[model samples]
Target: MKFTRKAQAKWKGSGKEGTGHLSTASNVLKETPYSFHTRFEDKQGTNPEELIGAAYAGCFAMQLSFLLNEDGFTANSLNVNADVTFEDGSITQIVLDLEGDVPNIDCEKFQQIARKAKEVCPISKLLNTNIQLKISLNN
Candidate 1:
C-alpha cells in the first residue's frame, strides 16, 4: 500500500526577511512568517516539524488504541503529546507522552502493549530520529 501528499512552498527574499506560502495539492493553504528574531518561534501557521509531531502523535495513539482493543481491553481514553526537537536543520528528537485509561488491563500489560505499539507504529518506523516514550495508565 502506498500513500502520497503533495505540498509546495514559495519563499521571497532571504531567510530572515523572507515569507512563504504553503499549499497542498488538495488546496489547503498556510503561511510562514520568517524573521531574524524568531528562529524557533512559530511566527504564524504550521511548520514542517510541528506537522510531523502532530502526525506521529495522532498515528501512534490510534495504533495503541487498536492494540488495546485487540488485547480485549478497551481504552476509556488515550491522550498523546509529541514533542519534536530540531537542531542544525535536522530533527534531533521526538518524545511521545501517552496517557490512557483502561478499565480492565493491568499496568504491566498495558505498558507491554504500548511498547509494542510504539515499536510497530507506522510513523515510528518511518522516523529516524531518537524516539522517547513515556506511558501512564489509569484505572
Candidate 2:
C-alpha cells in the first residue's frame, strides 16, 4: 500500500513581518494563514508545530483503536492529545495523552497495549525526539 500527502506554502516579505498561506493536496487547508507571530507569539493563525501535533494525535489514537480490536476489546471511545514541544527552533519532545473506554480490559493490559502502540505508530517511530505517553482506561 502506497499513498502520498502534500502541502504547499507561499510566503511574502521576510522574517516575523512576513505572512504565509498553506494549502494541502485535498484543499482541507485551503490557503490557511500562518506567520512568525503565529508560531512564536501565539497569534491567531495555524503553525507548523501545531499541525504536526494534530497529525500525531490523530495517528496515535487510530493506532490505539487498531490495537484494542486486535486484543479482542471493543473500544467504546478513545481520545488522544499530542503535546509537541518546540524549543530553540527545534522539536524537543512529544507527549501523547490518551483516554479510552474499552470493555473487558484491565488497566495494566490497556497500558501494555498503549505502550506497544506508541512504539509501533508510524508517526511515533518517524519522530526521534523524546516521546512519552499517559493513558487512562475505563471499563
Candidate 3:
C-alpha cells in the first residue's frame, strides 16, 4: 500500500521580518502562523523543528505499538518525546525519549523492539542525521 500527505506554507516579506502560514490537507493546521520570532525567539507560534519533533514522536509510538503487538504483547501506554536539534543551518540530530508501560515484556525485549522501531519508522528513515533513543520501560 502507498499513500501521500500534503501540507502547504505561504511566506511573505524578508527572511527575518517575514511571516508564514502553514496548512495541511487534514485541516489540522489551517493558516497556522509561523515566523522568525517563533523559530528563533520565545514567541508563541509554530516552527518547523517542533513540527518535525511531533511527527517523529507520533510515528515512533505507533511503530513501537505495532511491533509490540506482533510479539503478542500490548502496551498500556507509550509516551515519546522527540527533540530535534537544528544547528548552523542544518538539522544535526534527533533524540527520542520513550517511556513505555507494557505488560508481560522483559526489558531486553522491549529495548530491542524499540531500537528496531526507531530504525524502521518512516520519519526516522527520511531523516539523514544522527538519531538517538532513550527508553524507560515499565513492565
Candidate 4:
C-alpha cells in the first residue's frame, strides 16, 4: 500500500526577516505558519520539523499497539514523543521517547515490541536522520 500528502510552502524575504505560509493540497494545513521564529517559539500553527516529529511519534505508537495486540496483549495507554533536531542544513537526529502500559506484558517483551516498532514504523523507515529510541513500560 502507498499513501502520499502534498504540501506547499510560500516564503518571502530572508531567513530572519522572512515569513511563510504552508498549505496542503488536501487543505489539512491551510495557510499554516512556518518561520524561524515559529520553529523557535510561538508555534501556534506548525513547522516542517514539528510535523515530522509528530508523524514519527504517532506512527511509532500505533505500530507498537498493533504489535502488542498481535502478542495477545492490549495496551492500556501508549504515549510516544519524538524530537527531531536540525543542524548543518539537514536533519541531525530524531529521539523517540515512548511510554506504554500493556496488560500482562513483561518489560522484556514490551521492549522488544518497542524496538520492532522503531525499526518498522513508516516514518522511521523514511527518515535519513540518526534515530534513537527510549522506551518505558509499566504494568
Candidate 5:
C-alpha cells in the first residue's frame, strides 16, 4: 500500500520443459532459477509458491508485532510458517502457523490478535484464496 515493489520473471520454451528466472528489486533473488522440476518435483531451486509463502509469513509477522505494540506488549520473537497448497493447477488454500514469544500475554488474546493480523496483512488482503491461521503462544 505504501511502497511500490517490483519483481520480474522470464520464461523460455514450453511450460513443463522450459526454465525461467526471477529477479526482485532488492536483488535478494537475482535471476533465480525456477522450472517445472523445481516447482513440482522438489528440485533445488526457487518457486512462486515458496516465494508467496515467504512474503505472507513476513507480512503477517510484522502486522502481528505492530498489533502487539499497540496493546502495550512486546514480542521477543515471532516465528511464522506459511504453507501454500497448490492442486489441479490452482492454489486452493494457505495455512499460516505462528509461534510467538511474547511476555505476559494470554493465549486467547494472542490468538485474537493473530487472527486479526491475518485478516489485515497486505499479502493476505491481496490474495484471493482461502487462508487459515494456527497460533501457539509462549509467555
Candidate 6:
C-alpha cells in the first residue's frame, strides 16, 4: 500500500530570468515549460501551485466518491475544485469546492461525508495550511 512517483525539473539561468521544464515518469507532463512568467506573469505554462491544486482536486474527488460508495450511494457525478492561496511567499490556505449528484442520499449525510473526506484526504494532511470546504449536493 505504498507508492512513489517522480517528476524532474531542469532550470537554466537565475531566478527571475531563468527558464525550466518539468517531466514526469508517467509522461503526463513532458518537458513542460515553467518559469517566472508562467508562475507570476500570467503566461502560458504550468506552476507548482497550480499543479498542487490540480492534484488536490483530483484526490478529493476520488476520495469523496469512495466514501459515497461505501455509504451505499452511487455517485452519478462529482466535481471537486481546489483553490490554493499563496501569501507572504507561503501557501496559506486551500479551499475545496465539491458538488455531487448521488442516488438516494440526503444533503445532510452528503455534507457529513464531504467534511470527513476533507479532513482525511492525504494532500489535505500533507499541506500544513488552513483547509476550507464547501459542499453542494445535487439530489
Model 6, global lDDT: 0.90
Report model 2's TM-score to 2 decimal places: 0.95
3-90: candidate 5 lDDT, tens digit per residue: 7889999999999999999998999999999999999999989999999999999999999999999999999999999999999999
Best by TM-score: 3
Candidate 6: 10-residue stretch with minimal lDDT: 116-125
lDDT of each: 0.84, 0.91, 0.96, 0.88, 0.95, 0.90
Worst ten in a row by lDDT for model 5: 1-10
lDDT of 2 by residue, 35-104 (tens): 9999999999899999989989988888888988898987898888888999998999998899999988
lDDT of 2 at 50: 91
Report per-prediction Cα RMSD to one decimal: 2.4, 1.0, 0.6, 1.8, 0.9, 0.8
- TM-score, structure 3 vs. true: 0.98
Per-model TM-score on C-alpha atoms: 0.83, 0.95, 0.98, 0.88, 0.97, 0.96
Residue 110 deviation, candidate 3, in Å?
0.3
> Which residue pairs overlap in candidate 1's backbone?
none
Q: Which ten residues in a row have the lowest lDDT in candidate 2?
A: 73-82
Per-residue C-alpha lDDT of model 1 across residues 1-139, encoded as one tens digit per residue: 9999887777777877666666778774545433433346756566677778988999999999999989898888999999999899889999999999999889899999999999999999999989999999988
Alpha carbon lDDT of residue 81, candidate 1? Answer: 96
> What lDDT does candidate 5 reach at residue 3?
72
Candidate 4 per-residue lDDT, tens place, 1-139, comes to 8887788999999997789999889897889888878876765667788899988998999998898889998899999988899888898999999988888888999999889988998888999889999988877
Task: Return the candidate ranking by TM-score, descending.
Answer: 3, 5, 6, 2, 4, 1
Candidate 1 stretches with Cα past 4 Å from truth are 25-39
lDDT winner between 1 and 4, please give it: 4
Encode model 6's per-residue lDDT on 11-127: one tens digit a residue: 999988999999999999999999999998989999999999999999888888888888898899998888889888999988888889998999999999999888888888888
lDDT of 2 at 73: 83
Question: How many clashes in each candidate?
Answer: 0, 0, 0, 0, 0, 0
